[model samples]
Target chain A: MNRKSKDGKILLLQGNEALAEGALAAGCRFFAGYPITPASEIAEHMAMKLPAMGGTFIQMEDEIASMGAVIGASLAGVKAMTATSGPGFSLMQENIGFACMTETPCVVVDVMRGGPSTGLPTLASQGDVMQARWGTHGDHPIIVLAVSSVRDCFEIAVFAFNLSEKYRVPVIILSDEVVAHTRETFVPPSPDEIEIFNRVTPTVPPEWYIPYEDTGAGVPAMAAFGDGYRHHVTGLTHDERGFPSQRSDEIDALMRRFFRKITQGFHEIQRVETFMMDDAEIAVIAYGSVARSSRRAVIDARERGVKAGLLQLVTLFPFPRRHVEKVLQQCRAVLVPELNIGQMSREVKRVHRNSSRVETLNRLDGRLITPREIGDCLIKMYY
Target chain B: MAEGMTGLVHKYLRHDKKFPHIWCPGCGNGIVLGSLIRAIDRLGLDKNKVALVSGIGCSGRMTTYADFNTLHTPHGRALTFATGLKLSREDLTVIVIMGDGDATAIGGNHYIHAARRNVDMTAIIVNNQVYGMTGGQYSPTTPYGAMTTTTPYGMVEHAFDISALAVAAEASYVARCTVYHAALLDQLIESAIRRKGFSSVEVLSNCHIQFGRRNRMASPVKMLEWFKENAVRMHATSKMKPEELQGKFIIGVLADSERPSYNDEYEKVREKARGISVEPKPPARFEG
Candidate 1:
């Protein structure tokens, strides 16, 4: 079956292409990125399409500049994004921290590949799960989303942009080489069908506007560069007026607002999928490409008279802890499987509150965790 | 006629922000700031249309005083940020302020690349010869044999001629001026900002508190005298021999050329994509 795109034509789209199209649909008018494997297609697609929409696309010298440009463009009252793989993603951490400190809204697409240092460029791995959460130094709040399929790629990119704009924070969408390069049937949402969220502009006059003022809602209205609101923006620990403040109280209040905006808005940010987990003794928790394999394993286990269910994580950073906690209390034994050596499983272990036994299935040789391996593990745990 | 200095200050500065700035007394940064505002005032550009982006250092704090849409970014990345701002809002005038270490040492890649790409922005790099904000560490433009906190046993590396590097990188406009020459500094900055492509103005500023005390020039006056006695105009250097210009540096515009800016060239790409003559019509509409 074929699904219609914006032009009302059915098309087979790569995951990267769908992600770019989703960004365009989300009103992303500016893209700045350096070309890297597994993620370069996102940049290529944006370069080809952004101009037709009367948008801007720039191939910056490196990922550092690319991240800087995206943040800058976002401040100029346009939605902006950047894409990179592991190596380039590592280079973007400096500016990423700046974005967090300044509360700038932008999107970063990191296509996961095997890595410690320029690790496998073409092969798939979920190694960047931890890096996405704690890559930049300091205790900062970040939103990380994972895609399990090509269609998920399209939906998640739009969600990422909306979350970033609504909260005024940088959002990261993690895609592995498997999903980014795979071709699948895609039905893009029409412009009117999907809701779009833009950053809130200042409603007050220029004299009353404070660039970083916390209005009890934790998010402040933003003003563009050329707007009459001549406000100052800095990465320093700033006061309500956006000037660098060394006062202990001001710094404490500002840092608290950064976390408060996300934790308080989790209702709009977090998502998870539970499959047949209502009355099951055995459960599997997974995310990204590994979730697809785990879903298959759960279905196969049920056919063999074993009660098995699957928990698929979409929001990875603010770690869907409450949902995972519910599953932990209901199930007797849970298995966590992933491509990397137990990154997300650690989060599962951290949220363990009940008497349920938790175990992890791991792989690191640039290969996807197969359904057979997960099924075997589920069978052993059940028997 | 140029506006009175006090009027320019009143019109362009943010009075509500932190006054009594962080720069040391007798610092040349204040003079450079004055020249910048005078240049902007002389050009008659609207305050709402100017975007002043700065990088980390003592120089980066310039944005705190300016009334424009000021942004103080991370160290060495002001050009990158300015590039995005200018490309997105080409209607606005963009200016980037950076220090010696901020522009040449940590941001050398962006400096050269911004020149190569020729984005329409003016970069005013304050070459104070040392990183004054970080306690006088020797920077990329620290003169050889000059003493700094990092170069205790006399400096071993050579200094970078920032304007020459900009010229080599093919910046459409490149010029050099010193803080002591405030009037000339205003003219160079005004012209650089008016140019269509990437323009760099390297201001030889004095860190009287740091580099000046460590070197022979112990006070601001001594540093100003050094700039006055050792500088030669660019036109006069052609007549003078190499021996006469051994220790002296050239001042004035070194390179100015006409080339299409990145934005103008990108417009052509936009036309090729969406122009009626190039784009083919859809053969048939899809029936749901």
Candidate 2:
């Protein structure tokens, strides 16, 4: 099928540059980061771009401070973000956990390089999918979005910030090195084209404001510093007034509310794009740069009459499990080809535990999974 | 209400939510906290425009009882958060309070960098010579020959003159005072809060339970007496020999200069970036 028409002005960009421009467009006025491989472009762009926009950009001493600064800026009532690859992302986990515990809304873009202590800094790998979910300590909830192409990076960057502000949480934009380094034409939408969300504020006067009270939307309205709210915010688990309350009942209530906030908002939190799935029996699931190959594979499989389709996962966390399970219920078997070995495949299998066999096409050699490799799997699985 | 200082304490402390503030009885943190409150009160800074950030430990608890926009961060990370918050919103009077270990031990990197940058924030470090909250463990400031849980026999490492370190690290304003010198501590803090660049005060505070119990100075009065007896003034330091100053430190304003703050420097950067008075004009917001 030939694509017909498109709107918006075109600008050629790499995945990392798209992410930087996308974040700026999404109302990110504060960026603090330490440079790391495959993700330095974002920081460079911010350093070059933020100041002219009357925003703040800082090259922090390290990644821990970068994440801390973003959280700090967010608490001061401005949208903020930081980007890093795996090693820097590892350092960021400490404050990432801090942000989650304190319920600070911000964005973190982890352009994936092979990791587990800087395993292939210059190469591409979808190695941080699970790290994006469980990299930080504790059972705290997080939202992560995966981008497959340059244009998608721009779009998802906006979505990531929107989800962060709407839910008052940190949202991770996970991009692989292939997507990060490759160049593509990105269309810039008009200002009103994308929806932006700000943290909900208490309508009541400052005296009556309970900083952590559930706003019936599973989120506590956040008051910015200097807003005359004069509320205490801490990393320790606390009660409605935002002070450290260690009572077991209070802990349980707060913990349950953290999960409910993301779980109840699943419809908005989960995003996936389906291609040629109607009347198809076999599907290929992929994300980030691997999805680019999977797209070509699905197209070639269709030309060969294999009845193959593509399930592009845009939202990797809160893991679109229900939707994936529903899609798997219609297919015979799904092929998952990612840049890493069996990260998201585990989530897919767990979701479709008894429904169908979940096949994996993994690559760990720092190279892209080509279209033939995916189409071969499709042919073999379908026949 | 109770009369005298207790009345001011009652009025300033957040008694409803954060009462019985985790601080132990006769703790010198109470004295140090009182001095901080008196300084802020004397400054007449609007509570809404003030922000108090603290790191993990006895000192971090100060944020909870303070009725400002307070933040209690992880151990050793208060300065980084304060820097971020202050940089983003230059309208707030940001103040950071940390313990000896929280400042000079784990967060030493952030402490020095914040000072080097000379950001417009006041950092107050309460040096009780040991990590009291985690038990009587040796901290960065534990003097040589001091015994603690970590150093069973005695501390083999040399102690840091935190005030001198701040002065060396290019902080715009640095001072030192003991909890015993309450009124002088108030005056130094008032001047620090008014300083336009990085300002800090190393308070040679007390730890009656931790350092006191381990070192045979078990009572609160004995610790206060030690501070009163051993404290030296900044003016008197020049007359004393280096050997004579052993096991004691001077308490006064050690350094003060009107260096341009990081916030002010960043403004010039913004102006240069936008070509406000020269060169080509850049696009607004995200367009560039």
Candidate 3:
């Protein structure tokens, strides 16, 4: 597992392996996670790699602790991450909210498996689409990215870190069982090829550093613990000076800034791939591994003389409403093929002006919705 | 205390922040906090290099007033956060403050596992016997048959002897003292922080407003008196029979031994992973 040469050498790598490589490349210095099926390889790879790179990898007591430790390391001026599946993801929601409220920059990679509970372990599902957005309670902001291919895993892991650091928010990478376990030929990006983003540190003296002051950009420079700033970070609603505040104005300002930072950076944060969308009468909007199948369906449909295109969502939350809306407007009908029962279609339908124009092809029995199944749905909707 | 010592302790407080504090008058949380500050001051610790991590409870508020690198984290999860902080910044002295319920109830798994992991950090479990901030509910350390809002008919569960739990979990250092024993509190906490590996100090403080009122020890003074009378010094406990020890608790160091802390061990792990061998430094507290 040496650092792959950047000489365009195509090496077969699992999605989880690529993600771990990307995180290390993106400067993730600490990883604390619990082992879960489909996601364990990410931790396994990190455990093998992080320590050798002078980074730390710890198998925390549980997912809750894993998320907690990641946030703690991030606050200590290190980029940190944790990976888990559905049940573990549920346990991590509280600390995810803690990261949101305190504006801690960290990455949470949720390798999606089927569930409301322990539904599936060795299976894939996009069921956590909603959970990734609203899993943590509260009206908080989050950034979520989905990886469809092994290459996307490496690139998206880096992208997730950048978004988290820039916004001081918890970024979630949604990779399902298929994407995580699938191995593909990937050319590792050279160090010079990847752009890394680190959180802005305060330039002011320790006496003048205000931990949470909204500095016009809605982002306050962070000072790590033991850096002489000696500032307070808390889960409670805090004022500009980072002390807990009960004042309505301060509370309102904090909430506004949390949201405004992401909303204003929407152009930078939102990413979607429009494939063969031009001159198409019908569109299929999908994400994660299902998007790979959807792309095949669209290609098969086009060969059969149907005016079909694919809208692959690389970023899932902040909802990607603008891209979905455009696809909806341009195409007479839209099909969303996913492993869950209408989880993502619910979002597409929300943005589609005409509700009846959008339909979903769902396969929920621990199996993937194949290209043929999706193509049939698209053809039926076309007719 | 001398005027000079008082000034040193006050220097560690965040004066310009929210003052007058949030504690109800006579609550023992302030006393435990005072003990902690004095202990740190005695050790001559640099405020900048000490991180006070606390979980949700009345005890958690102590981090807010401490003029150190403070983190007020989620309930029952301060140790988890401190574990990460210490692993990354081994130079900082990490001290975790949690309450009875915060440590033993919702956070029980972390409490035992943190001890087992033996990370170099001091955990001050301010055991007030009930959830004071959330209104009096029976906590894990709440005395059996003690009445509370949720346990009006008295509690059915036996109390957790927290210090014993730590000792059983093989923590490097473990001690117990009541807030009534303020001098002992300072001594035990100072030793716990100074020692390497996971150290736990169970400070039996009073939540008179909640736990005390139901048990007829509502006055902070009465609770202190109960602690004073019932707590037998560890040395003296050896002379007492099991029957004589009934309804009494022990105060003093319950466990003390040396072990490789998690941070130091992880450093070795890093060395192994990198295929590099270096002379390991003797385990000692990092000088600020």
Candidate 4:
């Protein structure tokens, strides 16, 4: 896996393969995942690669176990991750919520495939946009990134681990089947070139260390399981001492900190790639692989003497509301094309004051929305 | 590290913040916890080098009360987490605590797989024969024909021999002891903790508040008395017929063997992976 060449050569690899390399570069020493379509390659790569790098990769019995194990490894002070698709993602929700409640830093990669159940195991879809945000129960904070390119599959993975450590929360790297299995060439970033944020450790004595004590950053310093600063971690609503508390004040305080940690940093957390949007009457908002279709559609609309631009979302959660509102203000109509029936459209409408100004172009036939379909929708809405 | 068993209890238990243990008054979790504390102390295990994981149940609450790297996860996923924790940092001693229902029902698949892999951790399953935290539901280990909230009349489900299951799953060490047998429970737990491969010790504990009351053995004392009368040692089970052993609780070292644990085998994989010769596969498929 550490096939670092002295010549700085670019390695041709699939999106999932690049992810394994990226995680290893970011100091990930653990991977636990159950095999599933679109995401299975990531585990296969990890199984073949991790051990060679002195890391551990375990293909657990199921997705539930896989998610639980990754969180456990993260608590043991290793950068850990688990990769899965539709069915596996549903199974992983329980422990993802537990990781959220426990404030353990880990990464979960959901390679998007079409589905409500196991609808399409190998086809691309962004149907899980809402699930990625609210899949876990309760009002817990999460950071989810949608990567559209093979390069992003590598870079954002390193970024996912960084965000997870910085916020002390599970950061999801969402990849569509197209992006996951697609092969491309990219120069792997050197360890020194990529900025990695490791979870901060407490300077105080073991007796004084409160595992869940929120500092000025809102993210608490974490002590690993074997760090000698032995402390408790639990999914139960816990006090600052990290012990379960039924006291209303304790529960309130913990939940407030969890949400505030990410919500307050919305400006830094939200990332959107805008194309040709400086002056346009029509705006198209899309994410994941659909963004590629939307981009081409925007270009075609421009050539056809119609003013159009693209709002390609890279960060999906805490849904770039301000950016969405800004784009809507400049444009008369917004076209949101997704693989599912209007999951992100609702989010867009929620942010835009005039919900009627936004239109959803959905495709659920186990196929991707084409450039022509998006172009047609933009014209129908704005022209 | 120098503390005796009693001193370790004071040292390890979170006295300031965690008080008033959450278990019911008549529950045997206290004895179970006490035995565990003593076992860890006697084994001279590093308190800092241990990570305790537990699932949702009365037993799940134990991790929060212990002064170690503790995780309280969803019901039945403790062993999965423990496996991950141990695999990541092989130096740390990971222990998982779960109730009978949590271990044998919802978490059954993970439990069997962990033992099958021979994961290097000690699983301390507190079997009270019923789901205590969520009220009285019949667990997989609930004695056949016992009344529970879920099993209104008599339990229609068969009892599971979890220790025997672990042994069959190839756990390096498998043992069981009742709360009435406090000294034996502690000893068995200590031995399990000190063992290398995947080891388990089922702590047959009293849950008078849940599993009793309906079965006509409501008091905690009556539960203990039943355990004292019914528990059979390992050797006696060999002499008894299936019919004769129907009402008995086998409590002893049921299985013990030597095998390379999961972690041990993984290290060999890592050793073999280093600078291995690579040979690309021959192309067979038409498409690139």
Candidate 5:
């Protein structure tokens, strides 16, 4: 409980380290993970800090086990988390879906790196943008928050945990290599200023505790393992009794609710920062590290007398379609700069189909897409 | 933590839902589930304190029927999830039930590591020799020369000896049993549950409809009979090598040793965190 509070002053720390500090601030008591590059620092930080705080930290055999451990620990009434990179994140998808189906509250921090495989361990890439949205083979909706800066990494990590617990679903904090490795000044908030959400505990007796029965809040009240509330949770399509139901109607109803629960709150879930969009005829839509580069490009373009604006996406999963539509309605053309070969640009084009011109500026060779490149793309499109 | 014995009959078993257990009639999954329920009853573990974690497979269906804190996780990942449950709630008894395909094939890495760390949990693997749920596919435990839907002629690859694997991986208590030996299996399961470290009980069950029919033991009764005939006690099989029993099954306690369990060792670290010594007070040792 004796945490160091530095009077709201900025302290230099890596993005991964900031995430660890942010999770600690959000009351994360249990961390289970296997080491993977770029994201290993988060696990290392939690391994050293959690035990000292009377919490548990486990280096699991693999990423899959790490995910499983956190889910299990969460059921035991503790806030749990794990961190991984591309390959490990892919391995965790099935269990991530399991957490979704069961409505388990947990946080997974994915430090994005290159590839469909073990592409780049130390290099950064945003290729996992689509994977974060549709990685698991199911219709379940997920909440993914993208962090563009070291400070944003810390804030979003805390926010991810809060949203995860509030919705009784796993919240993913997506950070690419540029944001994960970059060191920046961040102020750790006092406990009073930080918002923390805990899983809703059941007040009903053991016999009356139906694990999957919703409280009309779309999230069922959870009972930790030793609290004596006997309930069942499964990845299979289950009815309100928490028993597996193979019936089509039951499966349909459950799947619909699962997607609707998160998708319905898109207005609340979506977070984007708009710059110079009110007066601009051209816009650049970007997220994560690319967003930072796009911001610089927008600044440079405005100085050069081009009407270019920036739409920086902070929450990537809900896609911020409404915002994209609004921007496209006003702008004549949209430029999406990313580290992948047109992943989010496809989504932008899909939403703004036939309404606006959409162009992509992608770089996948383990190099950071620079502001100059984005500026060049804007200049070419405008002039 | 409370030790009390109760009658074998489980009041929670749904009798109204008779017949069609969702498993093939000759499948050893039913027998394994019976042993599990009996063990729970014998241990008198509060139903509320029992958490059954399972991965995707035919055996995974046990979580649905068992009236307790059941977690049906993804394929081959039950151990990882159960590890979380056990470490988070040290008082609750966490048991993982998974099939051969789920446990040894896809989840093999987790199984070995769970054993190596000796986490305090019980893993019950229903080794039916084939992937029955996915339709007659050869599994990691499928014997050499065994025919399956995938392996039309015969499988040339060797089968995994899960008990031996667990023993080598440092599981504190490792045992093997067959569904035919119901009473003995119940006792083994109960002992494994009571063991203070990571314990693995490989139940050699039958997928009579798939593996059984493919291997010529078509009927459920005949499959159970084959298990009975092939199994020999550890004492009887001591002089024989694994190759000597190529087509046969050997069922007995494989390994038992004393090792510091993950939870007990974790508590020692916790005590140190609280500024207390983990070592008990010792008198001076005399020279021999």
Candidate 6:
């Protein structure tokens, strides 16, 4: 298909719809998923657009199969993705870990809704903020990005795919119900301006190729099916040759490297948008929909003579700890507004434990914690 | 047979290793693995284009032994992992190898859905009737009234007829075989791998060390003999109902239908997308 122009004309589309369009533009050719509340629109959009764009889409029976198909398709050398919310995301955990261990490049979009089980399927919640990092039963580094606006959803979707391909690891876009369902004007970048990442493939012949041999980029060049690479890929503690091993030192090295590669590159993956933090004494830390509320609260607080600013997190995982620590050093106190009962608040507190006073404004009634509520909390905290 | 075909088969057959496989001596999983390797050799598939995915189980270990693009995933989630691999790389021949417990119990949901979607992937379930890896625990495929370590008396639950379930779920290809009939099992697996869309071959294997010893089906020879005596061809059983074929086990292809596979349907979409213009649409206000 011909590339679309980046004109300023407004087209009304849902958050999920924008994400699908962005993914298509990013060259995602394979989509597999099972429909779930608040996130089904992403699948619906893909179901319509993928086939028409020379891409593939399959409605899997459940979240587990959805994840499996994406992984399998990725191995066959396609840019693949899947979308889910809450319970479905929970079911995808183990395989998510497998994607991590095997270093497979793929994108997983979680449209967050209130949840412990099926708590509130149609409501917004940041409860999964921490779960996105620790849900899988292993110690592995992860890259998670949160979208606070409809425009950010499209931009972040493309970025998520880029990071997944660049790092050769699963990258997650954490979109809550508020952002997922919300519609906004998004001027997509011109085709030439759009950045894309393709996984590094092996240059050697199949016989000499070792799937897991790190090529100094902290990522091994991959060889998908039809590339004539007869190498094995597994979740087991594999040796450099990709064969399962039982040796303790080998296991330790593999696990250490898996964590080290992403952890070491934290600066590259960490992203945040600071608003008026340069001269503020009090900061409101937030992400996703809560960030939207905090932005307005910060603006009102500033006008009302309160030195309140916003530290909006765009990349959730790796927690942006370094930036939080630096901000805490200058600020007297920080207010965290989240949809869940203090999920990201705990992270903020943990990171800036004794450096600053961290207070939380939490809501879990399946409603967006309004800017007025956050503004009131800022006033009470500062006064 | 043609010289080229024979050479291709010889290339995949792991001949350097002798009869003593890595599996436990009485493990029926080895038989299932044997049948799979033989199937790949017989079909003459390009080793480079074939990928094997497995979950955590005694049978899950099959990927490590086989020479192919093997992926050993987490417990009870092999199908999910394989689904991703297959969808991303349509050119690769994807196969899911799991135990009865892995496929029908822990991973049961994935099985039905994969079949329902008719994805172009092969699911090889090695049904040993028990969870061999975690001691002899009863599995979903464990026959009713069968003795297990967990079920000291007999299993109270009825076994899932996986073949029937797959057929009902709209799987395009479905078949059943036992380790006893090596040649037939090989043929079934080979054909399933070659089939266009979601195909499943349930290999009723033996966990001689666990299930067999508990149920007095201990000897490997006896297990093979039981399969020979019990399993009847689908053609032979068609004339009879469930009552007439009461004690006999039915084997061979149970379902084979033509349907538009996922890849085929997806291609049509891609073609349409290609023909469309890329004129950017105007951005609009997003409302919740």
TM values, all candidates: 0.97, 0.96, 0.97, 0.96, 0.92, 0.92
How does model 2 score on DockQ?
0.49
Chain B TM (all candidates):
0.94, 0.94, 0.94, 0.93, 0.89, 0.89
Model 6 bad stretches (over 4 Å): A1-4, A353-355, B1-10, B13-21, B238-244, B272-288
Q: Please provide, for model 1 over A88-122, each residue's C-alpha lDDT reduced to its tens digit, 9 standing for 90 to 100.
A: 99999999999999999999999999998899999
lDDT of each: 0.91, 0.88, 0.91, 0.87, 0.85, 0.82
lDDT value for model 1: 0.91
- Candidate 6: DockQ? 0.53
Write candidate 5's Cα lDDT for B125-173 as tens digits: 9998999888989999998999999999899999999999999999999
True contacts kept of 6: 0.79
For candidate 3, write residues A137-238 as lDDT tens digits. 889999999999989999999999999999999999999999999888777778888999989999989998889998777988999999999889999999
Model 1 TM-score?
A: 0.97
DockQ metric for all predictions: 0.56, 0.49, 0.43, 0.56, 0.35, 0.53
Q: List the residue pairs that clash in candidate 2.
A: none
Which portions of model 4 miss their true places by more than 4 Å? A1-8, B1-8, B277-288
Give the per-residue lDDT of model 6 (tens digit) for B86-156. 66577778899988888988888888988987878999999888988788999998889989989998999
The B-chain TM-score of model 3 reads 0.94
For candidate 6, write residues A112-221 as lDDT tens digits.
99889988988888888778898888788789999988778888888888888888889989998989988775566777778887888889877788788755667788
> Considering only the true interface residues, what is the Cα RMSD of candidate 3 after superposition?
11.3
In terms of DockQ, which candidate is stronger, 1 or 2?
1
Q: Candidate 4 at residue A33, lDDT? A: 91
lDDT tens per residue, model 1, B190-244? 9999999999999999998899999989899999999999989998998999999
